[model samples]
Target chain A: MSMFWIHFKKEMLEAARSYKWIWVPAVFLLLGVMQPVMMYYLPDILMMSGDIPPEAAALITVPPPEEILASTLSQFSTIGLLVLVLSAMNTVAGERSNGTAELVLPRISSVLPMMIAKWAAMMSLLILSFVLGYAGSAYYTSQLIGTLEWGPMLGAGAFYIAWLAWIVTLVLPLGAVLRGPAAAFIALGSAAALTMLASLLPSHLQWSPGRLSAIATECLTGGDPSAWAPAVSAVCFMALSTIAATLLLKRRPLLPQA
Target chain B: MMEPVLRIHNLTKHMGSLTPVKGISFNLERGSCTALLGPNGAGKTTTLRMLAGLLSPSQGEIRYGNSGETGADNQRWQKRIGYLPQYPKFYGWMSGLEYLIFSAKLSGLPGKQAKLRSLEVLEMVGLQEAANRRISGYSGGMKQRLGIAQALVHEPEMILLDEPVSALDPIGRREVMDLLDRLRGEVTILFSTHVLHDAEEVCDRMVLMVDGRIAEQGELSELRAKYRQPLLLLEVEPGEREADWLRSLPERHFIEEAEIRNRAARLVVQDMDEARAALVREMADAGIRFQRIEAGASSLEDMFMKVVGA
Candidate 1:
């Protein structure tokens, strides 16, 4: 426990010192603040260009207040997912490659602590990024659409956090078990592939936490988040993945002086 | 024996289908400085990593001995080991002090204690002045020193340095060697090196590993006494019959073997004093005019060559 905390605190310090938390959030915040503003003026910009054909104009029917909010949330969440996945993939594998991971394993309790500390620190960073991005989107949306009913918006916010948390958790084990940046890319690609497969099913299949970030934007606009029963089914998958990762990583020996 | 701080019995490690580390075993005693000398691809690094607990054996167990019976024993054992890898790459963006402190924490030291120990080890490895500088700015030697500092910050009972001075210049090698030497009698320092001089200067005892096995192991004096041979070189002019005459002197008493090179004969003798006198007598009796005869003590390189050859 002490060793785990020590590793965790050291990671936090490293993150702070490197200002890794700063850049990811700064970029996400910029995107977050711009999403609603862009959504508001895109129609005007299109009208001014006189390129709004009759068929295309049918798709632009002055998006409802709920749809506008959903669009803003999707804008922020999509980028949020990518950045979090990229960051998480490099977590343990990078340290392993750099030869510093072995220096500690021999001195510490077990590989478990190292994996846990890395997971915890990364999750903290992921949560921080999601919250900051969501908050920026919320603030920007209010300025454009004027007023947010704390209830529905908060529910949408909760779903976003849950979906992001689940994705980060799934990526944790892949990042922990594999070596190099390729593992991170593979995890992202797998998540994307899973989402595409899920989309082929009926609305009932679309509630997977992995699929929720994209679908929830529509759900927040009065589409049924409940219609997606796969979210509950995915609970089993995410839990199993987390457990398998822990077990495999616990036994995976640190690469010796090779 | 001081209870063998590290004990590896029949350790075998296989990577995929290739077995790089075979069934090799050795014990490390407390406060004894030993060197693992081997050529490249000889498994020196693999052996050190197994001892440090960084690598698990495919077969066999590494039982770390300490004063305990159960749950707390392994934990206690780990806190006493410091491992410095052959190529330790730090976060180049981090300052030297930041890296040390991070290592201290990872080694299970509390913040305040970690800070104090980091400072102490930085001074020990001569990185105190450069502690605040970015690791990227450090020269190769300085980076190695920082690695050493991080390895020692926890004040482990056993310090395993893998080729600690392999790439350093003469001065940096001396610095690392001096540090390891000073720690002698206080901590068991086992460092692997291909450089024979590093082993000669700092190690009290040594183990020569070849093809993942201990070829020879003991104090220098013991190995010298066992393998030392008095060799004499004779230089003769071109097309001289001196080489044939020297070979005809005999190989029983003083001459162990003889080899001819161009016009010169190289003799392997049993005793230096006896060989010189006998050679002179032989030359006088044979009336052979030789260019020059020179004799000298054998070196570690000679002993290493002989061992490897054997």
Candidate 2:
């Protein structure tokens, strides 16, 4: 096996030992399932409150299955993204501070492969958690609400995953320089700021990866958002950050400043 | 004649305001255990870090290979060396065997071979019994032995250890020292320590550093002969007569330097016979009660103190 695989496997083992693999996916699955379940029960809940008028009950109709799934994407944008940032905050920063990087970095020689392995390991967890949660949300939406097409659902999930990946990749470069919580906070803050800026002037900033969430919503709700631009931008952002993170790690491979 | 496995030329590191190693150069002969001896803050750790590529030198080149040939850049040559920092921290979640295997694999050993070598080294470091236990549960000495095992797992040509036994208790120190003694001729070992005795215990050569400078470096036998000096130690009864005599001992032409305390003195003498005779004569004339008097040669500890104090 290549050195990358070796490091990647070690990461996976650590995730397993720390229960990140289990808890992260479980959190997302609950979030995804909660969205559709609440949508179906909101009208009944309003009626049972007794302070609500009959007219309010009639106005409260359940949203479509696609809309429920899209709303689930919004749920992910808040809690899901927070969970991801928290879980991955220490991937590099903790290694350095805990002094494990001092032991491992010297043996590897080049920092690039180690950085890439870290990215790949985090990606595996991210992809697994998102897919499992999206599937849970989709299953409930189809059963409780209405029929949905698989093609649009997959496309929507794909675009949103790319957006999530942009934020995830941002953590690495930041973690290479800063402490864990600081890196996580900055990454999530930048992601939120970028999303707001992109939405404020959609036509001017449509190329930003931040627009991916809205594009995912559009795809699910049966509107065609622009293609190839945001996708290419996400790839470029990841490439640049990986190189920058690798260089940062090489410059200060040890914690406590050696 | 055999060439050195590593040649360090002008290895220097400047950490902001202070320089740790100042253009120090030396050659590490193949299969020789050398100690980078220094006190705290003398830049021993910094030199080791630069050698391990954990820190980049401000100005210097670490040519890692034989005397007549320089093999590769830092990145390529890193595989030929293993390193253990002062306090090596392993993944607390990983078992001893798992951590060693991870290190071996990262050094480019294949899966099966990495496993075999990891197990082999675990046994070598006396960690085979605890190979399956988490590193968090290990005692201080066990952790250090595991650190050595990780450095040796890949079978690197040379191992660089920074203060390997300084952080350990006496038993742990002995364990590591014994292990190092067993490894002396098998690999080229360069380790740093503030304790001269630790260096003398296992190392054949010494590189003494003082204030980031190479104060002295040479083979053990050569240094012992070159720095050989005779000394006289005397302990007299506490009295005014003895005190007055000890005060005047430094003025004697035969005594080079005299360090007088309450009722005792350590004199570095030009001629042991002449100084001993003069001291006995002065004591009898002064009517001082002498407890014990001994003539001896100064050890390397004196050399260390004198060089560093200079």
Candidate 3:
């Protein structure tokens, strides 16, 4: 148990020394504030671009505050997820590639605590960045567009975090088996495939982890949550990723072959 | 009646099509330092890694205790073992002190005790002054010392170091050797090295590996006595006639096995005095321009070459 905290503290210190805490939240802050501000200034910016006809500028209607927040999530789904994946891609892969695993592996009896520590540390960073971005987006939406129900906004944030959790979880296991960029690409690809499958067959894939994204957006729009399937799947998937990473790390050589 | 610290039997690792560390076996006696001696690609690293629990052997048994009950996947036994790779890498962002503390903590030292142990280990490895420096700024020798520090911080029953001094400069190698010399008997060490002199410097026993097999292994003096042979070394300038004459000298009846190089020959003679006298006479009669001739004995280096020569 103490070993878990020890590893976690070291990981946090690594994150600090690498300046992950600074840049990750900074990117999230930019992505978050850009949404509502851009929607509010869309007409003026479009008019200034001269190529747009007067009719087209008038045709553009600013979305509602709740919908604007949801669109911000879609932005996060793309570039924000990319940022998260790229940063985390090296977590396990670097340890193996750089030969740190050789020094560390023999000291511990089981890899479970180390894997759990890594997952928890990553989750802490993920939640921090997401919360900062969501809050920034919510604050901007309330100021520029309209008032929002704090309860629903927080609810939307939680569901969106759950969705992102499953995606980030992919990094741990993939990083164990593949190099950084390959692992990042595959995690992104898997998330895309699952999300697409969920959208294509919503009823059939109601319990799919990918449904967390839609559930997140629906939370903002006061959509119903009667099914309760996506939530369960998201938690299960997170657990599975943590377990898979530990097992893979155990099965394979700790340090990569020189 | 006491069991060895660790016993390996018929250990083999099949990495894809290539088999490194083929059916090799040796027992590590308690508190004994054994060198996993081998040349490059002779599987020293593979064997050490298996003992370190970093690589599982494809076919073998690693017995840890007197009962020999716990097999290869001895999860609980991992805490008792420490490993430092040939080139031990670190999280470059971490300070030396922080890395040691982390390693100590990972091996189950409590927080306060981990810090205390880390500091003690840093001083032990002569890195206390540079403990706060980030690892990225460390020299090769400092990093190697830190590697040893981390290995010792947890106070494991045994430590495995793979070519600990292989990548260092002369001074760095000497420093590590002296430190290992100081560290021997405190904890059992099984370091790999291709340099016989390095093994002879600190190791009490050695497992000489050749082509993934244990060519020879025992107490340093025992093996030295067992394979030690009175021999002859002859060197001649590389003229065609002199080279031909030196090669012909190995074919004499008294010569046992002859190892001929470009202009040199290392011969194991049945009778050193008779072989030397006859060879000198033959060279003088043939007018061979010999550079140097010495009648001596075999060292570990000679044995190493003979094991790998085939």
Which DockQ values do the candidates obtain, in the order shown? 0.62, 0.86, 0.78
On lDDT, the candidate that comes out on top is 2
Tens digits of per-residue lDDT for model 1, B25-54 = 777788889999988888888888777766
In order, the TM-score of chain B in each prediction is 0.90, 0.95, 0.89
Query: In candidate 1 chain A, where is summed lDDT lowest over 10 consecutive residues?
Result: A249-258
Error at B72, model 1, angstroms:
5.4
**Segments of candidate 3 deviating more than 4 angstroms:** A47-58, A225-227, B1-3, B68-73, B233-251, B258-266, B273-293
TM-score (all chains, Cα) for each model: 0.90, 0.97, 0.92
The TM-score, computed over Cα atoms with residue i paired to residue i, of candidate 2 is 0.97
Residue pairs in clash, model 3: none
RMSD of model 1, in Å? 3.1
Best by TM-score: 2
lDDT by residue for model 2 over B182-272, one digit each (tens)? 9988899999998889999999999999888899999988898888788899999888888888888888898888899989999889888
Interface RMSD, candidates in the order listed: 2.2, 0.8, 1.3
lDDT agreement with native, every candidate:
0.75, 0.89, 0.87
Per residue, candidate 3 scores C-alpha lDDT tens digits across B1-310 of 1348788999999988899878988898777888988889899888888888888889988887565458454676677788888888898999999999888888888889999999998998899999999999999889988998888888888888989998889988888899888877777889999989999999999998999999889999998898888899888988999877766766688988888988999889987778878888888888889899998888888778878787
A103-166: candidate 2 lDDT, tens digit per residue: 9988876788778888998989999999999999999999898889989999999998999998
True contacts kept of each: 0.74, 0.89, 0.94
Docking model 1 quality class: medium
